[model samples]
Target: MSPFRKVPAYCRQSRTPIPFRQKQNEGLEALNTPLGAPRPGATRRKPAERAVARTIESDDADSLRAGRRRLGVVLKPAAQARSRNKLERLLEVGLEMMNEIGFDRMRVVDIAERAGCSTGAFYQRFADKEALLEALAQRFAEKAWTLLDTMLIPERFEGQPFAVVVRRMVVVMVRLASAHAVLLREVVRASLRDMRTWTYFSAMRDHMMARLFEVAGHYPEVTDKAAPGGPIELAVQIILSSLISRSLADQRIIAISDDDYAAELATLMIRYLVIDDAPWDAALSPTVD
Candidate 1:
């Protein structure tokens, strides 16, 4: 029997349903509506989505705003092209150094020299190397939000088979992970020592799951919504965990190309969503066959 019989009241389409992309504005709306509030305004979200939104409160919002500000904290005003160019060079050189050498061993003087700027110039922009990492996190977050908006709009998959849509979502995600490989790795390594880092990554992951949940709402065939144990959020976490593990793992260890990896993940998601009478314990079944 399918577990998705009753669409949650919150997810039911309004006469003029709000698109998920616009519903979530890179943390702009902040979802002030609590669960079960009247749907009179533009900021309404389903309770499940609100559950995720609740995690993003004053602290998370402050962190996001701080990141956006710090990204532009160059020595001179970012309005100047030269200062902007130098900032970009510094970020590029810093990442190159971290990949070539370890983050701990990467030095400010070396980074400035490689970026063709003075050490004084680097200091004027970023207080220290950790600040640079914060900037990188902000940059990765921006790239991720843009990609999610572009790829997951409900219109793109209107006529596609469910399976194809799942695969497209997985591919878009895998590419984002590949693009910000270093930043993700650093977040995991440094998160224990820095709550800010952990908060950034965690908040991003929750927002992603929440967005995907909206996309799933469009397809009535998703028959597992009412399953026990927060199944939808759990499934999303499982998929994201795989992406993160692969992003951080040694290529030699995982030994699979991103393309193949994404295909396998798409399969995992489809099976998870379409399974029959399976409790969360049996969700990870033997095979698609």
Candidate 2:
């Protein structure tokens, strides 16, 4: 989590990670989304119709090479059509229920009912209700990593002012929290009892700091590779902490919308960096660049 003077470069592999599985997928028809649902194509076709049919037949092979679903946190791996469909339905229903009624009150039976399945079917997929949460957390981490890969590229902010960069970064994080509000809140709650939950999201935090430092441009370049950290790095820590605190706690303390929150955070960081008449302060105001 410590900030470095030089821009940090993570290998492409580090940014987007999926669960590891050793065994390859069997060419189960249900696995082809065979049970998931069919695409729209009912009528007879032209000369290439035969070719297309051959391609459809090859989907099982494709599944062997690619299309295999990444089964995260499920105790029983599903490859058959009936079982795969049930597994998919359970996860969909469980996520919806978790979103609707907090995870604490969501029941396996309730999710099964909504998915038009029985409790036995749900049990066939997950060991317990908590397994559903771990699945969601795993999916959230996948999405979060992809989001960070796309969102935190400093190159995207090139030619923009550092102030604008800060505001954009704040806006992105606020919107991310909004989109995954339920998962994030649960992670925050669970993190108190088990700090492991925090580890999943911490990389995003560290990535954001590095991105901000890169976008800060040459205005306040850090020379000390060694750190109690540079002023800008420390300032970013405060800004990021403030945003996280707002997301999980003290919601009643502020009444502003996400837009206003971003504005305030960006303003806070800029002002802190650009304090008046400070002999040692590295001002990041618009006047600097």
Cα deviation in Å at residue 34, candidate 1? 65
Query: How well does candidate 1 score on lDDT at residue 6?
Result: 36
The list of candidate 1 runs beyond 4 A from truth reads: 1-68, 72-76, 223-229, 275-289
lDDT of 2 by residue, 1-289 (tens): 6584444333376764332221123224336655546533545567699899888997687656533443334244455677778776887787788779888999877898999998997776567776666566666666656665675566775655555655666566666665666777777787788775566677666665565555554434333321337776776678666666766665677677766776676677667666321111112211100
Candidate 1 local lDDT, residue 120: 94
Model 2 alpha-carbon drift over 4 Å, by segment: 1-92, 213-233, 249-253, 275-289
- Point out the worst 10-residue segment of candidate 1 by lDDT: 280-289
Candidate no. 1 TM-score: 0.66
Displacement of residue 21 (Cα, Å) in model 1 is 79
User: Which ten contiguous residues of candidate 2 have the minimum total lDDT?
Assistant: 280-289
Q: Encode model 1's per-residue lDDT on 177-199: one tens digit a residue.
A: 76667677887787768767566
- Residue 257 alpha-carbon offset, candidate 2, angstroms: 0.6
